[model samples]
Target: MHHISNPSILYFGTPVVLVGTTNSDQTYNLAPISSAFWLGYRCMIGIAAHSKTTENILRSGECVLNLPSVDQVEAVDRLALLTGTSPVPAGKLAKGYSYEADKFKKAGVTPLESNLVKAPRVLECPVHLEARFVSIHPLGAETGIDQIRSVALELKVVRVHLAGSILSDANPDHVDPNKWKPLIMSFQHFYGLGSQLQPAKLASVPERLYRTFDTESAKATH
Candidate 1:
């Protein structure tokens, strides 16, 4: 049975990413967003036109996508209603948004230097991707709303930084599913991965790697 109810937001569920962009003052601005997706080496992020992140990315042409673990949800949430824009827009103001020039300080996250981009990566995040802005496309206006518009930014990944704890010893390029847990946003709420139900039949993980993981699990249990 399906219920057809119009929901105010369509964020069903998505991995939360902290977008790092350089401000006009050459300072880094960190913003939390979930409307991002990746395909191949290119990633697309949807951001409001009035956001400082969008403006910075357009001018600087580079940014970092920092993937925080479930444990960092509180830090991410602290940045939810804070905007880097000095003059907070009326729409955002009405929604309880405030201006925070120093987002890194407010969120209590350390900024780490990146090799290929000007934007710094969040030191607390497990994964960091240095990317160069490719293009920005204006999205169609919302239903019956001519004043509101959004833009989708396409970025090409230039470098990827992964925490050693999340990397597989068997395959340096593969992230261990057992160790990597991403923070997910579901309809404005935060959630983490539940217990694994079963192994995928067509999993890319090699049999030997699975055996090693299973052996480690058994050893820990004993």
Candidate 2:
């Protein structure tokens, strides 16, 4: 049966990404965001207009997108109500968010240096993409937003890091889907990817064919 319905949010599902950025004080800030998508080697994430992570990215132009597996959901939850913004933003404060100076330590994740960016990567996460900021597009500019609340930030992945456990034995460059269980968020709740049900016809195409110039460019990056 079909029926008319409207939900406050349309977040059907998306992978949770721990965005790592360098704060003004040279400290590291990590934010878990689920409004992210990728095409080729470029990824875009939606974040609050005044978030600490956004401020850091705009200033430093570098960040690390860390993908956590299902097992790390506890750590992700610990950061749910913690904001790096000092004094805590008004909206966030109304929602019980408190200022957290050391998100990396609070999340219990170890940091590692990146080759192409100063933003450190989360050692516990299985995947890390050292990225550079490309641009930003404001969201909800009209409809009396009062103020721009969010923006979609584009990023170019300059380097890729992966855990060997998720790589295919047949080809190190390919990720074994069966082995990578990404943490997902749907309607503000955390979940894990389920086992594949059936083979996709799209599997007929080779993943390598979709590789972009950015992938090759990353090889020569420092």
lDDT of each: 0.88, 0.93
* Candidate 2 lDDT, 2-64, residue by residue in tens: 999988899999999999999988889999999999999999999998999999999999999
| TM-score of candidate 1 against the unseen true structure | 0.87
Q: How many backbone clashes does candidate 2 have?
A: 0
RMSD, candidate 1, Å? 7.7
Question: Which is the leading candidate under lDDT?
Answer: 2
| Candidate 2 least-lDDT 10 residues | 213-222
* Candidate 2 deviant stretches above 4 angstroms: 144-146, 220-222
TM-score of each: 0.87, 0.96
In model 1, how large is the Cα lDDT of residue 135?
Answer: 91
Question: Residues 19-117, candidate 1, lDDT per residue (tens digit)?
Answer: 999998898899999999987567899889779999999899999999999989989999999999978899899999999999999999999998878
Candidate 1, run of 10 with poorest lDDT: 213-222
Off by over 4 Å in 1: 141-148, 204-222
lDDT of 2: 0.93
